[model samples]
Target: MSIRANLDVVHERIARACLKSGRDPAEVTLVAVSKTFPLERLQAAADQGQMVFGENKAQELDEKATAWTSSDVEWHFIGHLQRNKAPVVARHADVFHALDSVRLARALDRRLEEENRTLRCLVQVNVSGEQSKFGLDPSALAPFLEEVAQFERLRIEGLMTLAAPTDDPEHVRPQFSLLRSLLSTPAPGGNTRLRALSMGMSGDFEVAIEEGATHVRVGSAIFGNRSYQ
Candidate 1:
């Protein structure tokens, strides 16, 4: 299928999921994960009205943002971002999804302040308790939010998580439930800036949508499988 055709199918699925959950389809935003997919592929998705693109690497993001100079595109840095790469991510990204530490937040805030830019960010929570995943522990999220609130330029919009990969999407439902629950709970500083749930991906976004995902980062579904060879 063409990118446009694939996008239509994805949106239809999102709408169906939203309908099933008694929510507005408009509430969920589809972020086409464009990492490792080259500019030509991005152009294909963009041509089909995909406004938001999620890039996982710092260099890819910087290059893509420069190459695809469409003021319409919203860039989301949806990966583990290091402190050293913070300045570059801060410069190119409109939303930073994996904000797991104070040091990374501080680094991003410092650069945003220098450039007179404010970046919307989501606290990445390791909901599945995977050591390999980079996010704050569920127990540590509220305090982390309280500590992060002091940064002037970074707005802690909500929470994001990558559920444990599974064959049956139902297996990861609890992980998504946990993340939604965290979003509802009040933070220490009354920093209840919670709304968006940046959960879900190509494999299990429907389940994420049902669980209350505001932003779904879908890559392979809409653009087809990426080739490394």
Candidate 2:
């Protein structure tokens, strides 16, 4: 199927999910994960009215942002970002979804201050407790949010998490629920009224939406599989 066709199907699913959960479809933002896909794929999705794109690497996001240069194409840095690469991500990304540490947050904040810019960021929580995932432990979120609040240039938007990869989407429902619960809980010493829950992907977004996901990052469903360079 064409990218536009796939997007229609995805949007239909999102709408149905929202209807099932008694929520507005507008409450959920679909972020097309465009990492490893070519500019042509992005152009195709953009032609179909997709404005938000998520890239996993800072370098790739910088390259793509420079190549596209469309003010309408809002880029999101959604992968594990390194402190050294914080400057690039801070300069180009409109929203960041994998802020898991104070060091990384400080780095990004410093760079944003220098650039005279402010960034919207989601604190990533490792709810599944997977050794392979890159996020802060759930128990540490409160203190982490407190520390992060000190950074003036970084705005704490909400929380983000990657569910445990499983064949049955139901297996990861608890993880999504946990993220929602965290978002609802008041953070210490900060008004962390998280408005965005960046959970879900192409395979399990419906379940995530039912559990209260405000942002879903979908890739293969829209752009097909990754084309490695």
Candidate 3:
């Protein structure tokens, strides 16, 4: 299908999902995951007024953000982040979505301070505990939130998680719900700035909305097969 066609269908789906959950469709923001897509596609989406896009790699984000600097697209870092890449990632992204540990958070904190910019970040929790996933163990959340709260350069926006792939919505419901609950709870250092719940993707965004996902990242559903990647 054409990109425009894909976008239209996805938009309709989002609306339908929101209506089904009794939510105003305006409450949810759709982020196009442009990880390996070309600049042309990114520009096309931006031109169409789709303001938010996500990239999974630091270097890729750096290149895309620079190449498309003239446009007004918001960038999100949605992949595993390495400490060494924090500098470039912080420089280019509006929000870092894969902040998995205290170490990564500290690195981002220092980098943002150096750049004199504030970074909005989500504490990635491997709620599913999949051995291959990258995130802070759920048990370590309290103290980690406390330490990250001390960083003035980074603002805690709330929690993000990847649920194990399963067809049963009931099985996945609790995991997304838990992440939503985290936002209302106080952070360790008394920082209650958490407001964003970035979760869900093409396969399960309706579940995410019902569980309170303010932002949902959708790639193939919007951009098709990721031609440039």
* Cα TM-score of candidate 3: 0.93
Residue pairs clashing in model 3 are none
lDDT of 2 by residue, 74-106 (tens): 898999988999999889999999999899988
Error of 2 at 8 (Å): 0.1
**For each candidate, what is the lDDT?**
0.90, 0.91, 0.83
lDDT of 3 by residue, 90-189 (tens): 7888988888777887888888888988888888888887999888787777777877777778878788888889877668888898888777666754
- Candidate 3, residue 170: how far the Cα is off, in Å: 4.7
Return the top candidate by lDDT: 2
Q: How far is each candidate from the true structure, as Cα RMSD in Å? A: 1.2, 1.2, 1.8
Alpha carbon lDDT at 195, candidate 2: 78
In Å, residue 202's CA in model 2 sits off its true spot by 0.9
Per-residue alpha-carbon lDDT of model 1 for 1-229, expressed as tens digits? 9999999999999999999999999999999999999899888888888989999999999999988776899999999998999988888899999998989889998999888999988999999988898898989986787888788898888999999989999999999999999987576543348889999999899999999999999999988998988
Model 1: weakest 10-residue lDDT segment is 183-192
